[model samples]
Structures are given as C-alpha cells and as structure tokens.
Target: MTKAAGPSRRSERSRVAILRAALELCREQGFGGVTIEKIAARAGVGKPTIYRWWSSKHAVILDAFMEHIATELSFPETGDHLEDLRGWLHSVARVLAESSMGPLIAGVVGAAQYDPALAAEFHQRVYLPTRQTTIARIRRIQDEGRLPDLSPDTLADLITGPIWFRLLVAGDPPGPDYVDTVLAAVASQRFPASAGGEALQ
Candidate 1:
C-alpha cells in the first residue's frame, strides 16, 4: 500500500503541473496552437504522462482554463439576488477583458464547431451558471411583483440578450454603458409601471 501511494502522489503532482503548463501555453499560443509536446516540456513531465491523462491537447487546455476561471470567480451568493446577477455579469466582462482570456474563450468557441462534446461542456460549465443566476434574479423580481410574471429564463434572456448580441455578433467589448442600457430597457419594459419608482401592479 505504501508503494502504491508513491505513484499516486506522483500522479497528482504531474496532473497539476500539466494543467498549469497548459494554461500558460494556451494563453500565449492559443488553444489551437498548443501541443502536447510543448505542454510536456513546459511541465517537465513525460509526453506520455500528458497523453495518459487527456485524450487530446484541447481537453487538457479546457480543464486547465476552466479551473483558472473557477478559481477566480466563485459563485458569489449575495442574498440580494439582483445585485448578485448584475455584479456577476460585470465581473465576467471584466475578467474576459484581460489579454489572454478573450482569446481563450474565442478558442473554445472556434473549436466547438468540430467538437460536439466540448460544445455541450462549454454550455454546461460556462453558460449555465452565469445565465441561470440571472434567471434567479428575474424570478426574485417577479416574486416582488416587479416584472410581468414571465419565467425567469425568458425574462433573463429579454434583459440580457441585447448585451450578448452586441458583444458576440458585433465583436465589441461589453462596455459599462451597454450593461446599464440593457438593464434599464429590461426593467422598464417588463414592469407594469407602478411600484414605488417603477415596478409592478
């Protein structure tokens, strides 16, 4: 059992090293350009070790990149759900504004065309949390009678879609002005026109 533990510990160390190396390489070279040989050399591990763990270089980089983001943005649980949703979007926009991050997401999207499983994973891991939280915010708004009682998912889309459409299709940065504009439009349009300043029936 002691002997078996030695290789097991080595495996954990090797795994971390590979993940770190893959992130650096993908940041510099883009995920499409990253290679297992490069990752292995950078991590100071054998190429077989990388191959042993990940089926493809993309898989290695995907795990590495996702881990990097997860560490940065924990799912913040402010009791004020609206504030949480807005803050989450703002923070997401800011994080991706970093030099390598934009490219990393782009690489994932570009690769998604050829990789069906990866596309699904991207939606699961990337889209759902961010999006679902906004849905929850919309739900709270409805509960307070601030919205038209639509489903949270649909309300979130109504509120957030324009922002995403402009950024994703127009290839523009998500400006602060645009975030506020999206929120304003959603708030006014969805509400029935009287709840203190402006809310529901």
Candidate 2:
C-alpha cells in the first residue's frame, strides 16, 4: 500500500478488530453487559479508536452479527419453494437456538423501542431480508401461475407469522410437523385468499 493507502488500510483493520471483539464480548456477556471499554481492551485498541468508528457498542455488535450470521440469515435454495421455506425457517430456529443470538435480537428490538436510531438500523439490516425472502418465494409461485395472485407483504407475513409467534410467546422449538404445516400453508392456501392461501396439490 502507498503511504496514502497505508492509513486507510490501518483504519480498516482497526475497525474490523473492534467489531470482532465487540461481537465476541456481546455474545459471551449478553446484550446488557458488554461495554466499549471492554471491547477496546479485548481488541487491543484504545477506547478512543472504538469511539471514533462506532457510535455505540450496539452498532459495533450489529455489524459483527451481520458478518457472522450472514449465511444463516439467508434463505436456503433447493429449487423447491416449500423446501426453501422449510430450510429458511429451520435456519432461523437454529440461530435462535444459539445461546447468544436469540437474546441479542430480542434485547436489541426491546431497546430499539427506546432508541429510534437502533430501531431503524435493526429493521433495515435484519428484519427486511427475512421478510423480503418470504415474499420472493410467494411471488415466484404467482409467476409460475401455480397460485392465485396476492400481495407480497401479505404472503410474507402469512408464512413467517407462525414461526415468530412460536419464538416470542410459546418459547417453543417447532418440530418437523409444524414446519410441514407451515410449508403446506404456503403450498396450499389454507386460509382465506387474502392470507395468500393456496394449496400446492
């Protein structure tokens, strides 16, 4: 790297180091416990360096989570829409099963209620992808003329609601039977058509 490039590269390295440390700390300590000073110490950088890059510990950890869970967050593809839904939902459940992620996401959402900035980033970065994926799958069905037309938003919600409900309220692990039902609902509209109800068979 040239002299000009040297500083930029160093900055990038420092930013990544801080993000990595912050993620590990937050995962190990829970959302309520991690701090900037601790992250700085863990990353071997000064507190000022961390403060210069990220507005808060939340931002740093958010970026780290985006990096670590990018694959898991993505809906899996198997050339079958129902299978895609099953794999995607199971991927979500598996992430929640992690000791760290469930609490981190729940805590972030709760905090975002008080911090508008955090709330905005969380929705933009994390919430939107899963929702859009659900919609895309349904839209593909519509394109294929296999299902009645429906709003993408409605379809996304219909497919994902059960999983979120089970996650937040029942605190339950959804079994294959439940996944089958969800997949079936997508393949076959079970409710009124407004709910994007369609039967695959």
RMSD of each: 5.9, 4.8
Q: Pick the candidate with the highest lDDT.
A: 2
State residue 157's C-alpha deviation in candidate 2, in Å: 1.3
**lDDT tens per residue, model 2, 1-201:** 645558888898888888888777866776667888899999889999987877887788788888878888687777876567678777777776676777666666667788787788888877776566677777776677654456667666666778767766677746556766876766575445555444322
Which candidate leads in TM-score?
A: 2
RMSD of 2: 4.8
Clashes of each: 0, 6
* Colliding pairs, model 2: 187-200, 188-198, 188-199, 189-197, 189-198, 189-199
Model 1: how large is the Cα RMSD against the reference? 5.9
**Candidate 1, residue 99: lDDT:** 69
Predict model 2's lDDT versus the native.
0.73
Candidate 2 stretches with Cα past 4 Å from truth are 1-13, 145-148, 173-177, 190-201
TM-score for all predictions? 0.76, 0.77
Model 1, range 1-201, lDDT digits (tens) per residue? 455558889899999999999988877887677889999999999988888878877678778877888756554677866666667667667665666776677667777888787777777767776676666667776777666655566666676676556545676657656676777666666444342231221
